[model samples]
Every structure is written in C-alpha cells, then in structure tokens.
Target: MENYNVDTVLKDIFDSKDSNNWKPSDKIPLVTKEIETLKNDLKTFLKSSDYNMDAILKESQELCDETNLLVSGMEMCKQEIEEETMAEILHSIENHDRLTKELESVNFALNIVYDVVQCGKYVKEFDDGREAQSFTRAVEAVYDLLQYIEMPAEGFKQLDMYNNTRHTAQLILDSLLSDLYGEWDRLISTSVKPGNKKTTITITLNIEDSLIVIDVLNALEKSKKLVEKVMEFSQFLLKDVLVPIINNDCIVFAETDELMTITVNQKPDFKPAYDAVIANLRLLFHYLSNKLNVEYYRDNSIMKMMGKQICAEFSDILVKDCLIDTIPNNINELQSYGQITSEIEDFQHFLVIVKFFPDDKISILKYVNNIDILFASKSSQYFLETARTIMLKDLSVTMSIGVETIPEGNPGTSADVSGTEEEALKILNKTMPRSLFYFPRCMISKTAQELLDLVYVMMEQAVQCSDVVCKKLYNTTRLVFELYDAVVPYHHENYLQTIPQYVALFHNNCMYLAHNLQTFGDKWLILMEGRELDYPISFVDLVQKLRDLGYRHLAIHMQQQRKQILDNIRSSDLNCIVVKDVLSDNAEAAVRQCLRQLHLLKNVWIGVFPINVFTRLMATLVNMFVDELIHRVCTVEDISMEMATQLTDMYTLVVQKAPLLFQNTTDVEQYVKSWKKLQELIFVLGGSLKDIEKHWKDGTGPLAVHFNTEELRSLIKALFQNTQFRANLLSKIK
Candidate 1:
C-alpha cells in the first residue's frame, strides 16, 4: 500500500547536478530510463502478487462511514443530556451562592471570638505569672496580650469590645512595667563609705536574679530604664571605688597597720598602685559584663555609658593627679614614665575591648601621649644646663691618643706588659713591643664626647616619643647642639690663638662633632619612615654650620700664620736685597723663620691629624710661603743674575724643605696649586729671555697655564729689558 512515484524518484536520483561536471539536462535520458524500469517492476509485482486491491479500498470506505455515523450519534446524545440537566445545575449554583454568604458571616464572628479568647487567656496567664514572680513569662504574656488588643482585625476595630480590651491591656502593661521596675530596684544597691584616706564601696546585687530583671525590662520595652540604672550603678562604682583607689597612695586594698615595718632601702614607687588600680578597673568591667550580664541589657551598649563615665573619671585622675606626679626627673625616670604611659595606653585599649569605650573618645592617656612636651621642655633645660656645666667645668683639652688593637691573626702582633704577673711583688718587667698603637682620630675633646653622649641620649628619647612630642624633642636636640655650636669657639678663643695643641684639638673636635652630626637627622628619621612629615627635620644645615665653625677657627689661625710670614717677608725688603750678599740676607732669614714656624706646626700636627688632612694643611702653609716669596720677587724692577741667584737659592731651599712636610705622602706639588707656577716664575726671572720663551712654549706650556698673561707681562717688565722679543712674547701670551 506504500506506493512510490517512480518517475519523480528516478528524476530526483538521476537529477543530481554535480557542480563539478554534470548538469540536470545531461542526466535526463538516464532518469527517463530508470523511471520506466521502476514502473514496469511495480506493475509486474502487482500482477503476480494479489487481486483484492479494490475490495480492500471498499472495506476502508465502509469503516470511515461507520466512524462518521458513531460520531454523529454521540453528538445527538450529548445535546439531549445537556437539555435534561441544565435546570438542576442552575438551581445548585443558586444554593451555593446563598450558603457561601452565611459561611463568611459565621467565620468572621468566630475569628472575633477566638481572638478575644486568646487575649483573655494571655491576660490570665500574665496575672498568674506575675503572681508567681515569673517575670520573663509574665512580661511575654503582657507583650502578647498588648500586641493582640492594640492591633485587632480590621472588622473587629469598630466593636466596643475591642476598644475596652485595648484599654484593659494598656492597664496590664503599665502594671507589668511597674512590677519590672520594682524588681530591678530590689535587685541592686550601692553604698559609698568615705574614709580618712580612702573610700569603700558596698555594692549589693543579685547577679543571677538581675539577669531575669534585665530580660523582663527588655521584654516590656523598658530597656532604656535598664541602661539608665546600669549607668547609675557604674557611676557609683566609679565614684566610690575607682577614684578612691587611684587617689590613695596605698596599693593594697586592706588598711596597713602603722606598726608594719617598712624596708628602708625600698623607694616609694607608684607602679604598684597603678597596677592595682588597673586590675580593679578590669575586675569591675568583668563584674558588670560577664557576671551581671549587663551586655545583654541594651544590646551590648549598656557598658558604653559606663565606659564614658570611666573615661572621664580616669582621664581626670591621670591628667590632674597621676601624670603630675610622673614628671620625669631624668632620662631613666623619663623612660620609666614612658613605660607607665605605654601601660596606660594598653589599659585604654582594654577599656575599648571590654567596657565598649570608643577608641577616639579615650582620653585616659591623652596627657601621657603628649607628656613628652613637658618632658622635652625639662630635657631641653637639663641638656642646656648639663652641657654648660660640662663645657665650663673642663675647659682644658685632655688629649687621648687614638688607638686600635692589632688583629690577632697578624704576624708580630703582641702585647706589652710593663707590670709582671707577680706585680704583687712590685716587679717591673717590660716587653719589647705593644700591639696597641696610637693613630690619628680627628680627636674630640672630653667635653665634646660628653656632649655627644648626651645628644645620643636625647636622640633615643626623641625616637621613643610620640610624633607631637618628638617634634618638641627635636628642638631640644637643636638647642643642645646650638649651645655647643655657640659656646665651644667662644670658650677657647684665647687658647685657640696661642696654643697649637688647642687649635689642633679644637679642629678635631669640630670635625668630630660635625661628623657625628652628619647622621644625627638619620637616627631621628626612623620616626618618619612609615609616616610623612610636612616639614621634616634635618641636621644637614646644622652640620654645615658646625663645619663652617671649625673652618672659621682654622682660617683664623691660618690667617694669623699668613700675616706673620708676610710681615716677616715685607720687613726683610726682598725687592731691595743686595745682589751678591747671599749668606745672611733678610730674605733668607725670613725664609728660614717661615720654615721653622712651619716645622713647629708640623710637629704639633703629626700623629694628630690623618695623613691627607696633614698634607693638606702643610701644603697650604707652604703655598702661603711660596706665594709671598713670588709676590716679593715679582715686584722687583730689574733682577740681575746675582739677585736671580739669591732668589733661586731661596726658592730652592723652600722647595727642598717644603716637600719634607708631605714626606711619606704623594708630593707637595699635588696639594699646592701655585707651587709649580712659582718655580716657573723663578726660572723665567733668572733665565735669559729665551728660557722664558721656551718655558712659555708659545702659550701652551706650564708657564702659560699657571700664570695669566698680565702676570707674565708684569714679571717680564720687572725682570727683562723692553726688547721686541719680550713684546712679541707678551703679545703671543694673549
């Protein structure tokens, strides 16, 4: 019965148009042949298989006709049933509508009765619970009854019974509130007993029963009253216990008998009393929060009020009494006070944790935090005074030889023992050598070292202080150094001039002070590491000031030495010296005196200053000497060969002796800038005009490098005749 259209099937199969090669028209003949073959096969199969095709079709038609007849008959039956039941259905709907209205009315009246009965039950339960002193349960019943009658159903609102019920519930709530208050009043009491030296608190409270009272008060919506009552109790405790403990000097709670022996060596310390006060305050907090369960009284906020009161009272005690006594007298005492302040801060943190004190509102350690202000003022005065005392007491310089022990592994390093192991027998045994040896230290004075030690102490205190107080302490640091800065030079003005040892020691002291002060700000910078400062303190400027102070004093001495040598040279009249008299010329004596003075300074400076600094100072002296000689010779109008010979001899003597000042170091020429130029000028003055031109090297030589054109011109005019060669050299020097 499932027939296929062979022509269409064959057309679809053979009509495959391959986009690569074949088109629909090209496969038409094959499609026609296949359709014919399929049709023939279908006909042959039908003819060979059966002959009942028409009869089957007729049977299917008959079944369709029978289904149609059944469907039509059922429709007729449905219409007949609907006609028969329509009137009864309408009547049932009418009865349902009428009963639903009556049901709604009855349910409404029943809900009202039920609600009223529930109210009455709760009221009765409240009355019974109140009688039984079950305040939690009684309060719960009153709360429920009040809620029920206060907000009745919308339909019941207009009824007189509901209005009366609301009134009765209000009265019941008032009575419940009154009973809760009465119970609370009976649960706790406080009595303060003031004594001669202390005050005692007598607190009576039912810890277990107070919890019940708190719960009843909370349930009755009277928690504010509970908070108020708790605050009142805390105030009494603060007044009677906290204040008295902090005020009394005795640490122990029990009164001590006068007959109790005191330790004579023991000093009176407030720490024990402070510890006891803190411990008692902690116990008070525990008693309120953990024992009485006051945290639950107002959602953990009941203690905040108490905390505020404690904050006020404790803060007052610290500021007005305790901190006033804690004024530190010295650094060690200040350190102790710092520790106490730290403990006070920790106590404040504890209050924040347990008593619900606000961190920002904590003022108990306010004065403690800023107490460094007072301490800084006192410290500044103390440092200034102590520095003045130290500076004034020992104005004399006590020179300490700077030494370091040779490392043990080094060869030939040994110790010198003057006294024998049997020194008890007064034996004097001496060793050949000593491992400990002296070296240069830009040596600081004893007073300077003491001042530095004081600065170190102040620095530590500043580092330990709070930022606000640290700033003030920095001023103290500045004041201490400023005092030294002003006082050191003024104190030793006379010695600095006459005493070479004093000058050297003073120079070393200034160098040491400046060197130590170089990192002075760095130590204080530890405070600003994690914090930003608007105006950061630095010792850079102060360090420069100290250096300048040292240089200023050194310059004063150098200028004095300079004036002495220059005066000696001026008085010798080298410009008018005899050409042939070379044995004992005034210039030679001046030169000798200059060298002698330099040698004396060298002796004082050796082993006192580091080699480089020694070389620098000696070279400076040599330069001054050579420069004055050059100035004298350059002023001479005509230098005969004999005068040049005398000047050359003086120059050679200076050169030979000046180098001995830097004996082991590099050379005098390396440190002294004008040394080579002075030699070149002396050569040019003594040599013929050719020697001058050759040394000049057509303006590209050492002569041209050291002496300016005007200097060489002046020298040429003073020493040489006005020849064209000199004029041309002068013109080329430009």
Candidate 2:
C-alpha cells in the first residue's frame, strides 16, 4: 500500500481473517489515524476492487489452509456432540428400566397384602372363631406393612391401600351373607312341635367361586386405603347381607305361625331347639327363589315333611279309635257264627238309637249338655255298633215296655182309671212309632205263623220224650218260643221290606245256636227231634234219611224242570214257546239261585254233621254229587231219598272204576262202608228210574220218551258200569 509496513500487512491479514476462511488473531489498533485510514482503505478496497493480490494470494492460501482446519474442527465437534447425545439417551433408558422394576416390586407386594386381607375377611365371615381371629390379625399386619412401604409414592400408596382394604372387606361381607343363608336353611329344615310338622328351607348361591375370586381381585386392585376400605366393605355386607337374612327369616316364621297353628297335640312333647330355624330356612329359600326366579316349592323336603305329617296324623287317629284291634276280633267272631248275622241284638239296640238320631240329634244334645258324660255313657255303644256293622247289617231292636201302677197320695178329682189307661196308651204310642213303634198284630204278622208252627211241633215232641233229656228239650223249646215272641212280632211287620234284616237276625240266632251246640254237643238237635232217650241213634237216622231223601228229590226235580222247560220251548204254541224261551234264557240265573240255596243248606249240614258221619256217608255224598245237588235244589224241601240213592250209586261206581280216587287209606274204610250203603241206594234209585222209564215209554208221561229214556238208561249204566253213560249223566246233572 505505500511502503506497506510489515505490522500493517500482518494486521490487515489478521483483520481480513474474519471475512475469509482465515483464523482471526487478537491484535490492538496502533493509532486513531492509522485505525481510521486502515478502516477507510479496507472499506474502499472492499467496495472498489480486489486488494492485496500477492498478499491476498498468500492470505488466501493460508485462509484455505485455515478453512480446512476449521471445517475439520467443526466436524470433530459435531461428532463429539452426537456421541454425547447418544450416551445421554442410553442413560435415560437405563434409569427408566430401574424405576419400572421398582414399581413392579411395589405392586407385587401390594397384591400379596391384598390377598392376605381377603383370606382373613373370608375366615371372619366363616366365623371359625380362633382361626378367623388369627387370619384377621395376620391380614391386618400385612396391610399395615404395605401401607408404610407405599407411603412415599403418594398416588400409588393411596390407590394400593384402598384397593387391598376394599377387596378384603368385600370378601368378608360375601362370606357372611353365605354363612347366614346356610344357617337359615338348616334352621328351617328342622322339625318343630305341633304335629311335629317339619319345615324345609332351600337356598341358592348364584355367585360362582371363579366370579367371587375375580371380583375380589378387581376390588383389591382398585382399593386405596386398605384398613378403612376393608371396614367399609364389611359394614356394607352386614347391612346388605346379614340384616336381610335375619329379617326374611323372621317374616317367614311369623307368617307360618299365622297361617297354621301347628297343632302338635299328637306330638305333645315335640320341641326343636330353634323355633326360628324354619323361618330362617324359609327366608333363605325365598331369597334363592327370588334370585333364581324359578318355582321350587314342590321340593323333596317339603313333600317329605307333608307326607310325614299326614302319616303321623293317620296313625294317631287309627290307633286312638282302636279300629285295627276291632277288625280281627269281628272277623273271628263272624267265622265262628258259621252264618252271616245282620241283626245283633246289642248291635240292634245301638242301631235303633243311631237310626232315630242319625243326625246325632240325641247324641249331640247329650254332648251339648255334657260331652264327657255322653262319651263315657255311650263309648261302649260306639265301639260295639262299629264292630257289629262291620260283621252284620239291617239291625233292629225291640225293648219290653212295662207299666208300674202308682197309688196317688190324694185324689185331686174323681177316680182316674180312664185317664191312667189313656196316659199309658199315649206313652206306648209315642215311644213306638214308625222307627221305634210296636204294634202287637203287625209284629207277629209274617214270621209269627211259621215260628208258631215250628214251636208247636217242637213242644209236642218235647212232651212225648218225657225224660230228663226230654225236660231239657222242653225247656229249650220253650225258651226258643219265648225268644220268638220277643223277636218275631217286631221282625215280621215288614217281612219282605225287612227281609235283609230278618235274614241277619236269623243268622245271629243260628250263630247263637251253633255256639250253644259247640258248648252242649248234639243234645240240641236231639232235643228238637224229641228222641231224648235214643237221641244219638235217632239223630243219626234222621240226618241220614234227610240227606238221602233231600238229595234224590232235588236231582229228580231239577231234571224234570229242565226237560219240561225244553219241551215247552219245542212243542208249545208260538206264544208259549216265546215265553218258555224267555224263561229258559234266564235259567242260568235261576240255577245259580238254586245252587246258592243248596250251598247254604249244605254248609249248615256239614257244619253240624258228626265227624264220624262226615267221614262216611256225608263225605261220600258230598264228593260225588254235592255240585249236582246244589244246582238242582233251591231249598231243603226239594231233597228226596231218590237223589241220595243216585249219588250213592254214582260214588260207588266211580270208586270201583278208579280205586285211586279213594287213595286216602284213612277214608278208604269209610268209602267202603259208604259203598255198602250205596248198594241199597242203587236198588232204590234203579226202581225209581225204571218206573219213570216205563211211564214215559208207555206214553202216559208228559216227559218225552226219547228224553227220559236216554236219561234213565244213562243214569242206570253210570251207577252200574259205563264211563260214557256216567259222563253223559254227569253232563245232564251238571
């Protein structure tokens, strides 16, 4: 520049360093003028032209070198900064991981504390006493420790404690509810007094184990203040769970009492420990029912209870009435009677009272006056009548009326003979009306005639005997007649109307007679027959004769009747044939009636037959022809000697043809004796059959020759030898 100073040159180079890529150096300005001049020259040169070419060149070279150095330095600095930034990021990441691990540890500890608290609460609800207390204490300690540790992290500490406590409390409350419900159910299931009616309780828990666990976990997770939260949950449950259970149980108990007075008189001493148990059980059931919303009333327990109550009541009543005891006694007595009895005299007396006061008028009146007195007075009547009705029917009674003459202390007016007679008539008339009335004529009207005839014959026979036996017979006959007087007149008034009643009375009398016979032996029959001295012989003869004659006559009559009816149907006019057909159509019924009557007579005879005779003649007759005899005879009057002969012959032939039929060695001797007797019967029946056959063959008999001829021949052959003929005769007879 004008003799450029080295210092200036250096200064210029240094100052320009800022403008170019040159390193700037710290230097002081020399003088004000020089600094001004240098600044002006620098401005002029910068504005006008490129200055300091050689110097600029040298400076540029140096600047280029410096630029290179500066760029290298900047790149190094950038590299260092990038390395530092990466290191800081890595450090922050490490710190975050450490904090995360610590938080996780805290959460894990809180969870453990919450679980312990929940377990404790559950134990408390279970009310396991010492076990529950220990568990609760352990839980509380765990919760306290967890709270202390979590205190520093304000948000986490509060939230964790609350969640743990709340969760534990909820578990305790739920357990309490379940326990209360269970207790209620047990109480209701127990039986109580007043008929010992049992009550049933049902409960349903809807919450599953998994669901309970899940809810408990959720509550614990959300809870913050452990202790307060636990207590709050417990209080909530006590109010929501226990109170409802208790209230519901009480209501159910109260309602049951109002609905039915468990009349436990039958189970007088029955008492259960808990009266409220049933109610509680019912409450539990109600709760379950409501929660489930289903019908469960017909539960097995309920049905069982109902059934037990019904059975117990039935047993008590059945025992108290002594019905079971009376049934066997009545049946045994009936069997002994050997005949059905309708009119038991004692029973008749009871029936008379019952019928007249069927509405219990008299009895009720008496009861109203004094129940105990009525029951005591009439207890016998009730039991006896009940038993008699069970054994008989159509009962009636007659009470003897007596008049007592009384002397008046003084006559108020004239002599009162007419008044006294009228009064007596009124009393008799009023006391005995349609139900309890007695008219002498009406009483003796029907049965009196038959009874009197029998009595007359009996009296005559008794008189003829004229011995001690005869005297006994006479006394018995007199007594029978006296009994007739007592019963006949009252019974005969409505003979057809009261036939059933009469039959019952007859049965009772037969029973009485049978009892007497059993006590006194065949003396009664002998007395009736009037052969007091030779009673045994006479009785046997009479019985045998009756059997023979009765059987024979009945068989013949039946055969004749059947043939007559068939003949009528075949040979009669159309109208007559129609009528006969109608009659024949009902023949089965008629036959059955005949058979029943015969069976009755047979039963009576068999019952009274001597054991010896039964083993001999009667047994044989019964075996061979009892069925035929029953079918043919409607009454004892139909029996005849001819029938007995036929039966005897038939039995003899059968025994001869098939000896095995008489296999019983004990009875074989009897059969032989019976067979001998049958030989005589054969002769008698053969004669009758021959006579009937001859009459029909001569065409002098209404019996068709073809019919009677075949029947007679068959009967003879069957009695004699042929199986075909016997079978044919059996068919006809049967």
List the candidates' TM-scores in order.
Answer: 0.42, 0.19
- Give the poorly placed runs of model 1, Cα more than 4 Å off: 1-328, 334-376, 393-441, 465-471, 527-537, 575-584, 663-666, 685-734
Candidates' C-alpha lDDT: 0.68, 0.38
TM-score of 2: 0.19
Candidate 2 regions off by >4 Å? Answer: 1-69, 72-690, 698-711, 718-734
Question: How do the residues 502-547 of candidate 2 rate in per-residue lDDT, one tens digit apiece?
Answer: 3333333332322222323244454455343443322232233323
TM-score attained by model 1: 0.42
Over 1-734, each residue of candidate 1 has an lDDT whose tens digit, in order, gives: 25767577866765565646877687778778876887898788888886877798999999999999999999998898799878788999999999999999999989888887888899889888777777766777877877777766657877887878788778877876787667766666556555554444554555453556556556544323566676777776666555655555433221121111111112234343566567656655555554353544445445566666566766787556555555673557776666777777787787677755776876676665556667766666776788788766453555564443434442332355344534532222134233222234445568878878887877777666666656776777787778877776778778888777677777777777777776678777875577656567778778777778778888888888888877777777574553433334677888888889888888887766666677888888888888878777666555565666777888888877887777563478798877897878767856887888888898888888988888788778766778899788778777
